[model samples]
Target: MTSLVTDTRVVFSRELRPVLRDPFTVIFSMIQPLFFLGLFAPLLPDSPDGGSPLQWFVPGIIVMSCLFGSSMTGSNLLYEMQTGSHERMLVTPLRRPALLIGRALKEIVPMIAQAALIVAVCIPFGFELHLAGALLGLVILAGFCIGLGALSYTLALASKNKEWMFWTVQQTLLFPLLLLAGVLLPIENGPGWLQALSRINPMTYVVDAERALFNGEVLARGTLEGLVAAVLVGLLGLAAGVRAMRRSD
Candidate 1:
């Protein structure tokens, strides 16, 4: 057990070094969320419930940041695969599960940092959140990130061509999930079919939970549902990712 933990940490450090060296990648990842926060949030009409626009919008932006950032992780894996870096790692003494765990765990660091930055920026704009709620939201986001990052890596490993993975992620998966999650606008106000579809999306629960948390409603039904969804996603993603790694071996 100790060896597995140590190997996972070592693999995590190896994957994280390149990201640390290229700080711009982190900045670039945050830009889209910032754009929505700065430009789009202001244009939103006042909430019917009397909350500030930032309060209503910031949670969605945080979820957006997590989704976009983590879902794109597969592209990095594709690069490693093409360059033979992933294959080289396979020759090491590292366990297959550790390879996926380490990479997936590393995703939590940047995601948490990004979530913190988003909240800080929104604070000056009148976003209100309890520290306890904020911490809970971060925990939820961590689970979501681990799951999405693992799934991304698994998809990358399954694809024979990098372009296929890129196309599928961007064109097929990302936008549909984003739209269904109601990141840009509330689905409740949409037509009946759209609302129905949103109900089935796991991300819908997550975004709703985030909004409840941001409003300091820690015990809200949405918050509980989101936590459950996040755990399920994390388990399923880790399972699939580990299976993919074993197949590669």
Candidate 2:
């Protein structure tokens, strides 16, 4: 147990250091969320409680950030592949799963920072924060990112630095996942088929949980579903990521 933790920390540290040095890209990633907040949000109807759109939209945007950012992390591994850095690491004594876990762990910090910045940006625009709920919401967001990040690394390994393959799978899935989850728009009023699709999409659950958490509905059914979905994703990602790591190892 101790060794696994240590290994995870080492891997996490290695994954984190580069972003700590140059965070410009991290900030750049925020522009899209802000754009959605500024532009797309106004086109929506008010919250049921007569609140600003931020009440409903902010949490969704946070999840959106987690989704896109974690998914793109595979490209980093692809870069390591091209330079043979990844090959050299494979020669080290690190545990295989730790390699993947550590990289996935690195996703948390930047995501939290971006979430904080987004909240700060939204506050001046009349977005209210539900402290306890927001914190829990972040927990949900982190779980989703860790799982997704691991799968992304697995994809990177599978692609063998073939940028086209990696991007193809990512682009094909992300927008569909994003839209189906109704992050920027409500699917409640959509066609029966669309709403049915949303029901099966786990991201729809997670997004609902974020909004529920943000609204301080701690005991909401969506919250339970979201947590389950995150755990399932993490487990699936770990299984696949570990297999990919072993193959590469």
Give the top-scoring candidate (lDDT).
2
Worst 10 residues of 1 by lDDT: 160-169
After superposing all C-alphas onto the true structure, candidate 1 shows an RMSD in angstroms of 1.6
Over 113-186, each residue of candidate 1 has an lDDT whose tens digit, in order, gives 88888888778878886789878988998899899999988888887465675656555887788889998888
Of the candidates shown, which would achieve the greatest TM-score relative to the real structure? Answer: 2
lDDT of candidates 1 onward, in order: 0.86, 0.87
Q: Give the least accurate 10-residue stretch of model 2, judged by summed lDDT.
A: 24-33
Model 2 lDDT, residue 238, Cα: 80
85-187 in candidate 2: lDDT tens per residue?
Answer: 8889889888888988999888888889989988998899788889999899889888888889989999999999477999999989988888999998889
After superposition, candidate 2 runs with Cα above 4 Å error: none
